[model samples]
Target: MNYSKKIFCQPLLWVIALFLISSGCQPKTEEQATAENRETDTESKLEPLTTENVVEVLTSYEKEHADSLVLISTRHGDIKLRLYSETPLHRANFVRLTKAGFYDQGEFYRVVKGFAVQGGDSDTRTMKNGAYKIPQEFNPKYIHKRGALAMARYGDERNPEKESSSHNFYIVQGEPKTVQELRAFEAKHNMKYTPQQIKLYTTIGGEPSLDQEYTVFGEVIEGMDVVDKISEEQVDGQNWPHTIVPHKIKTINQ
Candidate 1:
């Protein structure tokens, strides 16, 4: 064999061997390829909810995630809530966002003493406004009592249809409404108060004026004290708390 040819062939063999070894190191196993395919499929399937598809998407989402119970944990205390199935769209939207890590990124930013504690739209969060809105799922039975969970929305001047905010929400820490006050609200809003509503407004107390104005989707079942504490936080001119109350919202079942 010619020494020149032998030398050249030796280096070429080594280079080919090295290339094969490097390529073989990253062997894509069957399980690994399957997992990657599944991940890609899931990502492709999840589309954004828009005004045209919000109702349809949420209606489908509701069937799978019938989760109603959610827990909001803050440094002050944990607020346990029971989402109402009556408001399916609102409940499903909330559950979806909670799973998508939406509320985990925000805080109880707006605290209005004796009125409500607004959250799920903190300045710290990136989702300043929702991409889509849920239709007003106003159930007359759901009054804005203390600890009642309701969706926040823009004013009627701009939003005549009264669509609910997809992310922002408030828990009522309302003061007691006198019978005279309830009557005044009914007359002004053309609303009628039931015996149970009047009793709750007078006794346990709530923002009676908010009845039917916003969609009440849930209620604080176990942590009214925490709700009260959050509401009483010292706030600024914009109702944002001086010391922000960061929160992590989670579904109890999920």
Candidate 2:
């Protein structure tokens, strides 16, 4: 497989594993993956947050919604996104972070061309600001189409509920697929997408297998080329950009 196709396939494999996790299919020990991730992210005892704290924050922001367009200013270019009103919890968290300048100067640390460019954690800023989880806000109205803005979270072993991370997010740069390709995914992964979703995957393109697994709360309204460019940038062994590609996000009056 070529580089872009290879990158796209890796995530689908993970999604398949997630599907299995839901249906009593065991692929890898969730314990191993969770342990590795924990080692990668050393515990920070400072300003630790609780579920109650997160719930309280969610309650206080019930009325908060994205009335203005949000722009993620990146080194490649600005990516304008429209947060979906249907997914209020995820939308509110994104809007709150953008307004607070939490994403400013953050680098797109993980970039996989034709897959995603992930950011929202610049030097552990979320932890310093008191990080918390948001309940899964999966809406059928949203799918992982190219330019889709979605939150990233832990693997199924640790996050069985599919809870989303409070800060980290990604923009999809997925490629279009044929009906045959999608059917193979359905058979291998033991999941299915709606006919409309399948149509979207075969046309405009997206990681269709990720539809219900991740929280896709928004989509790029402009500068999709920039997101694509970021995905294609040179990266290190870890898929992190060779050089910093910073993202500065803010709320703009429409």
Q: lDDT of each model, Cα atoms only? A: 0.72, 0.68
Give the alpha carbon lDDT tens digit for every residue of 73-175 in model 2.
8778888989887887888777776666667736677677777788776543432334356788887677788889888875666667887776778888778
The clash count for each model shown is 0, 0
RMSD of each: 21.4, 7.4
- Regions of candidate 1 where Cα sits further than 4 Å from its true position: 1-47, 126-130
Clashes of 2: 0
Which residue pairs in model 2 clash with each other? none
Off by over 4 Å in 2: 1-49, 124-127, 184-195
Tell how far residue 45 is off in model 2, in angstroms: 19
**Residue 189, candidate 2: alpha-carbon lDDT:** 49
- Can you write out model 1's per-residue Cα lDDT over 35-130, one digit (the tens) per residue? 443544443323445567889989999999999999999998999999999999999999988888778877776566777777775434443222
Query: TM per model?
Result: 0.78, 0.76
Per lDDT, the best of the predicted structures is 1
